[model samples]
Target: MKRILLLLSLLTIAGVSAAQEFSGNIALESLIFSEPGLDASQMDDNITLSFKPKWTGEWNDGDDAWSVEIFLRADNRDEGREHADIRELLWLHLDGDNEWRVGINTMFWGVTESQHLVDVINQVDQVEGIDGEDKLGQPMIHLKQYHDWGVLDFLVLPGFRERTFQAAQGRLRFPIVVDTSAPIYDSSDEDNHVDYAFRFSQTYGDLDLGVSLFKGTNRDPQFDLGPGIPHYVQMTQVALDLLLIADDWIWKLEIIHRDTDPSAYQALTGGFEYTFYGVYDSDINIGSLAEYSYDSRDEGQRGVFDRDLFVGARLAFNDAQSSELLAGIIYDTEKHSQSFRLEGNRRFGDSWKGTIEMQVFSNVDPSDPLAAFEKDDFLLLEIARFF
Candidate 1:
């Protein structure tokens, strides 16, 4: 993987140099724990640094282009977290409204505030954060076509990427470290399995609709403790995502029905966001978000948001600093568990910015899935300088 990434980086750098269109950034991040015993090591340093560089170029009047991004960190707390990745390394060709892309790229789908049930193309960078918002790029041949009916996307994934996991010394992980090195697959070819997907999306007036199908290994891993190791199970999934825009209110819905060997179930996440613009003529915007998530599985489920309600608020100052604040709470009705998160960020001049985030878990029952993270509350600080 290191050799492949190095080669790609060299190629991307060369291409960007030839095109003379280079841009990137330098970022510094620090994580401070509110309490100890979260990870196995309370003696490690609380502050760490990471470096990310990105470059992109285009030719033939923007019809052809290439982009690459590299992430590197200095901390060695968790072997999986303190690593490097080629977040994006793709070549794109455009013809009218149709497009073709080849290489590793990241894609997102779904229209919900709390969870993304229909977004399954890219693997999650689990070690990055617990929100599951960060993703690792996947190698694929992607095609997008536009028509009168809507837009259709066809993806041919030649290789599968294993999901990252927290090591034993990681803070936001279970007591027993999941061994992601030797993952088992249902297919004989293992990581070489060819996964494919199809999606069709359309927008009519203020309503947007999307339907998708995926057939291959599941992104979420299922534990196999019999062999005293962790592995993943293969599954097929079909999903639907919908969004409705009405004035200052937006409604979102995501439903997924999947089948696996041991069990087959359906999951749903429905929500809405209401925003008030220019509140009191102060150039401040406030938005309220409410969502409900459900899973067909009973107790001892693998996920934390099985029967949970999520309520959140977002505040945007819309000033020269570009300041923003977001606060949210997730309440599990079934297990009587709750989690809260606070996030804020602001820009300082044209080339520098900073961010602060905090997460807290409360009222967690022993039987709840989030019980492991009860003591993992933490605060994160990040600053970046753009070029």
Candidate 2:
């Protein structure tokens, strides 16, 4: 992750320099813990804070095209206890339309979310992240353009399949050739250099339809593989990502199959299958979820049939007060133990403002080692400012 940040800085410098604009916020959260095992000796209260800033800049070439962006993030918790994630990307074009991006940015799009700014703020705060040696071997630059109803994007980068396979296991995979003009990826093996995706999207009334046909890199991100796995053994999520949205309904249909190897990273994204959707509101609403993830990374690996069906709700007493709650029954995913949770947050005071919240996690299986958590939980109250 440090290298990623370092690379971002280097890219900014390498490009034509320009003045930039910025804006964001900072927040501090106070908490209290009461875990049964460690509850006896617990802090009455703890503090967790977040900060974020942005970069708004652009570069142009005559009247052809230009790019602009504003990015922000926070990288830590309880000062710097948690990991941080990147968040932000707003682009523009002087002539036609541009829609589509590759690499990490694509991962963000595949998942529906609105907490990117919050994610970036967390990333800035996290000092610990994907171990250094586990970083993506290929640094890619992908883009998309449009013509009528069809779309096109080139996952352009160093060398293709032929050359890449030859250089596999060796550190010299990214070959550089000098030229009198400028250095460019020798697209000679362009065929083995597969053009991964082709998508088409349109709208009708409250319903929207989108189809993506691309060569997807494996499903479960490769970062989970750890540093020991050779880069060549990686998996790919080559399939179609279909999405449809109608009014309060959101559906994500992924048709992905995996290639065999060891560990979660080797399989395509859908190892744990899920297909169910529910909707909520701007402030309060309730929704249900049923999905499964073949999460076999930690020592607590459970077999494939871990299915969960649950309902979650959020409420706001008013503009300044609110609460959140969720409860569910999980099977195989928890055949041995049933699971549940409850949480709420509220704000109070005039001159001295404070936010209070509590969370409880429990397991139904008495024999399950995690059952003790049902009787023990954590509470928090935070007071701070936003500027």
Candidate 3:
């Protein structure tokens, strides 16, 4: 709370010398996708809202230079499993182009491996910079992290926090026992659970990089292939994205790297590493999706590395209809096994979006015990809204 107050005070001081501005944004959607290997439910839509007021100023107190921005975002929607979570975005700039920023930036990292590199580069390149606003897209938080030239920054993350949780209720992925003899976690305790998160990130330029070392938890954290499992994931992420704006088209190139452990309770947690490469056209909304990802983990072999291919698109049918398509193939290196996936996202009206996903795994390797439960198929569906 003190930090919030201090931020408000700075905003007040900046406003006293000049003017105050108020603005907001709203976007909501609803729809339904295919549920993974379960009874399909009826389609549904939801609502969410965001409001913000902002104040900005240039204070030149002798050698003391300052700038500040503060904002608040609250949302309520039926599609959300947590119901609601109110978050804040704070940005402050000092001297010329150096600044500070804090908040949840979804455009930072996405659910797919192809989009992962964008987050990493954003972290490593941030060096302290971002063009940000409230959930409404209004200029709510601005730390002047950048000026005409570049940015200056620092990172502060002292110790780490650790927690061990269980998949008590939901079913997002397989359950992970302390030591399991199977490739997939135990299916009985299937639920997407978030155990703990030890994360840190930094920025350089058009590049952002973030690293999170933690256990998995929450229904939201589960995998779509199987019931979400409560696994210990030692995750590391790096992303680099470049956006080029031209007269008629925009060109974007991004790369991401990730290494994760599928099981947490095991004595030695060694798992798979997935990498992504994404390219999008400047003028198209349903930009193409192409990615390369791989994973390697076996019975006695705690870890190995495999590669996969991804292809799809973020297609928009019209002003009121929008959808994203993600399709790819995963390659099992050991026995040359292979898997394929099809994921779809659709938006209804302006406030609701539905996601439908499906996966098929194929392998008859008798030597791999984990391959036993590799079902030839699976599916998932979800509805999400933004305000």
Each prediction's RMSD to truth: 2.0, 11.8, 12.2
- Which numbered prediction scores highest in lDDT against the true structure? 1
Model 2, residue 340: C-alpha shift (Å)? 3.9
Lowest summed lDDT across 10 adjacent residues in model 1 is found at: 37-46
Instruction: Report clashes for each candidate as comma-separated counts.
Output: 0, 29, 57
Q: Estimate the overall C-alpha local distance difference test score of candidate 1.
A: 0.84
lDDT of 1 by residue, 1-387 (tens): 477468757866675676545666667777776677555564233566666677787899989998887666655566657767778888999999899999999889999978888999998888877777888889999999999999999999888888887666777777667777778887787888899999999999999999999988888877754442556677889999999999999999999998875788899999999999999989999999999999997567547879999999999999999999999999998788999999999999998989999999999988887888888788889998877
- Candidate 3 stretches with Cα past 4 Å from truth are 1-95, 102-112, 115-153, 159-175, 178-290, 293-305, 311-319, 364-377
The Cα RMSD in angstroms, rounded to one decimal, for candidate 2 relative to the true structure is: 11.8
User: Model 1 off-target regions past 4 Å?
Assistant: 1-16, 42-45, 226-228
In model 2, the worst 10-residue window by lDDT is 114-123
TM-score for each candidate, following the candidate numbering = 0.94, 0.50, 0.42
Off by over 4 Å in 2: 1-20, 36-46, 59-95, 99-107, 111-140, 150-233, 239-255, 263-305, 316-359, 364-387
- Model 2 C-alpha lDDT per residue in residues 264-376, reported as the tens digit of each score: 32111121212232324344455444434333334333222223233333333335544444443334344445444444544444323455555554444554334433443
Top-TM-score structure, candidate number? 1
Q: Please give the distance, in angstroms, between residue 369's alpha carbon in candidate 2 and its true position after superposition.
A: 12
Q: Candidate 1 vs candidate 2: which has greater TM-score?
A: 1
